[model samples]
Target: MPKYIMILLSIWLIVIDRCSGVSSPIKPFTLYKNSTELKNDTADLWWTINDAWKEITFELHIKSADWIIGLGISSAGGMKGVDIVVGWVESSSKVYLQYAVPSTNTTYHGKIYKAPTGYSIKRHAIAHKMLIDPKNVNLVHHLKLYECDPMTTLNDDQLPDGLCDEIVDEIKFCSLNFATVWAVGGDAMREFPEEAGCGIGGDYEIKYYMIQMHYDNSRLDSSTASIPSALTVPPRMEQFAIDSYCPSEVTRNIPKSGNNVIFALPHTHLQRISVWTKIIRNNAAMQYLFNSEKYDFNYQYENRLLKSIKLYPGDSCATRCIYNTKNKDKITSGCERTRDEMCLHMFTYYPRMNNFYACITVNDDSAGVLWIQLR
Candidate 1:
């Protein structure tokens, strides 16, 4: 996690609109809708974090499984390190509601990398260019780059430059802006009540808040989703959410293995009605940690065990998700998109195993390939 250390920092509360530069009253709650596609099936995503809005309710009057809806707090417009509560109605009529947050480490080309904070990335990139550009006198003075190295170069007066690069490197965006807090999901329609501790930093309190909604209609032709924040603030927790599977793009059968399972949530699209995570030893004896026989798509929740189960490194762990296919209709399966069925068990284990909390068994191919034989 400590791949890079970002040093100098200051808090910046975004009280005014980014575009309009006009200030609005800090309210107890806010609601947002996608104005671009207003006629779609999604509902307005709402959230609150004020004195009176301890218990925020989220209601979706969805008509079909044509959309994916979720919301949470974040420091910026992006999803990294955000605390999100997302849900979707699978084509199989199963509904799933989950609380999820993206890790700071992003996966790309089968590699993990850390991205800088959005503000820092944007601000420094501009500062870097202006420092090198001799013509940007206004920018140099505005950023106080002139204070670093005001002496003109002996070669060319116009070619001379302030220590803009050095000044930019000396300052950094606020570290507190990333604070966030959220819960996954429950049978209740409303979000769990939470206190408003957006930090008590007098005037410099971080103000940027972000909420995003994603709707998936890949199975069909289309979809839409919403929320907004003037200031960016991160959650206050630092814990890892890990999953045990194969390496990225690598597909391997679940060999006998064992580990303590603290929380388990079986994930599969609508084609599944039942899913199970069992610990198998010697390829014979089996112990179940999670099982959903009559699984409903709308009420998927993280089934946390009262105690962590013991698993052996040599013990094989298997996941079985059953889907209903009348045979009279068409069958869909793939690695990406909802039309294709998936079999994955999202688990949070105790006693950290490796730096990589989540493992991918199959890259981006049809896990449904295995489903074919199981069916």
Candidate 2:
């Protein structure tokens, strides 16, 4: 077991539409001619697919009504961070929907947020551009749009503009896979190439997406382009480094045609002095994928290669971030707050790979500090 645990209890859930009357205590529902049912001691679920509309409708019968029920699809493994939706009909009889990433959160006055909020894809579609929310104006410093696992079914409720702090259990899922990244003074949007895109309807469609925004109403440093004053950077060490990587085993999902990447963004908080990502093949350095010489926390944008880098089934990728922390004495590890630290590399690739959604592994990570049930 990990160091800490936070479990969300699931209570009884029932559903009966206003148009339909309740069933008698001794009587049970009869399965429709074309529908199927699954039942247990407390709940029964009936569902059927509408091929014509490409939709599936579900009805649930919970033995009790103490709590609402949430249902969605996911990978065979337990749902820690895989993109899935959770829905519940509140006691007010109002339907409530939310992204299944974590519990709904809120923002504070002086803190910077890196909230990964979810958005659902109604059908098969291709993403062409990712732009900063103009409404947010100078508040959003950096943003990353990540594609949830295609096989998952996640929800998207317009939760309040919230602060997204570090949730230990979500580190793996949230940091590994990113589809688009937009930073301060970046292009109008993160655009894709004409020849290829992430995915669209059918087998390649993404089910859900989460946009992690750094919400800090800080002005840009006009001269040095150094760390902004709004972000808290405590000096604790002379120098420190963080690393993130994708192993060769994860390359199995790469197709024979290869995966092509055009642009990459190596991200960090305020202290990084240098950053780089290297592609390794056959246990040797194949190419220096991206190396930011004099890293600047401000003025961050994507570094596009002259040509696309293609990777086959056996290739792997690694990234490193070096920080100068000589000023004060403080402890900081990987975290979501801009005041803390994060080392991540987000790149846009062509010909999406299904199972190869995420390959990042956090260095020196223990089991976890928190556990929030999403089943």
Q: Which candidate has the top score in lDDT?
A: 2
> Scored by Cα lDDT, where does model 1 land?
0.36
- In model 1, the runs with Cα more than 4 Å from the true position are 1-214, 217-259, 355-375
Candidate 1 residue lDDT tens string, 201-264: 2332232222111123233332221111111112231221222323222212222353456666
**What lDDT score is found at residue 255 in candidate 2?**
86
Give the TM-score of each candidate. Answer: 0.35, 0.53
> Which tens-of-lDDT digit does each residue in 238-331 have in candidate 2?
6666665667777766788998888877778677888888999999988887888787877677876778999888888878878877754765
lDDT of 1 at 129: 19
Deviating ranges (above 4 Å) for candidate 2: 1-136, 154-177, 201-204, 217-238, 363-375
Error (Å) of candidate 1 at residue 215 is: 2.4
Native RMSD of candidate 2 (Å): 16.0
Q: Give the whole-model CA lDDT for all candidates, comma-separated.
A: 0.36, 0.54
